[model samples]
Target: MSEILARLAAVEEENRQLRQEVEALRRDHADHRETVGREIASDRRRITALETPAPALREKTAEDHVNRLFSEMRRLNIRQTTAKDAARLLGVSKPLIDKLKPYLATDPRFLILRDPHHKQRHLIRLAGT
Candidate 1:
């Protein structure tokens, strides 16, 4: 009977130790989760701050800059100029030529014509509306 009591006590102690370990693990997990949540919220706030436009930004947007360039080109009556040429005239990156091309392609000001007797190259001119 004494041996049986000793075994029962040992088993109870083991069970208690296991329960404490489990509780500790649960607490650690909860703390880790809270930390991760805080980090994610901080990242989200940082991203939001970056999303807002600066107060000292330019009045001329990319589209506006492109439009101004086109107006300058028409005023100068300079046709057959490549995208690089326009980019130079506008003092912007060359890649912006691709971005602005779509707007000017549909405009009536654009005239796609081949030079006389020369099918190897093409010239873009401004046709009168």
Candidate 2:
């Protein structure tokens, strides 16, 4: 009976130690979660701060740049201009001028034409001019 009691006491002590370890683990988990949350919130704040100054720092909006391009197109004496010419004249990337196709389609003052002799070449021209 004394031996059984001693074994029971040892088991109880082991259980107590296990409970303490479990509690410590819980605390460590909570601390880790709190740290991660703080880091995520800090990242969100940093992203917002980086984004806030962009508009005021921009040289011009897309609309303003496109309007400037139209004005320049109007001032040209030539009846028609190629994409390369327009890109050179506007001092903008060819892809940027290419993006204007949908806008040009809707505008009354301009037309897009394909060259039959030189396949795949496109021209921009003043309508009825």
Largest lDDT belongs to which candidate? 2
| TM-scores of all predicted structures | 0.52, 0.50
Q: Over all chains combined, what TM-score does candidate 1 have? A: 0.52
Q: Which ranges of candidate 2 are over 4 A from the true structure?
A: 30-67, 70-79, 82-88, 93-99, 115-122
Q: Model 1 clash pairs?
A: none
RMSD of each: 6.7, 6.1
Model 1 lDDT on a 0 to 1 scale: 0.71
Candidate 2 per-residue lDDT over residues 1-129, each given as its tens digit: 999999999999999999999999999999999999999999999999988853331224445655666678777676778877877887887776676666666677778899666798888887878
Stretches of candidate 1 exceeding 4 Å from the true structure: 31-67, 71-77, 112-125
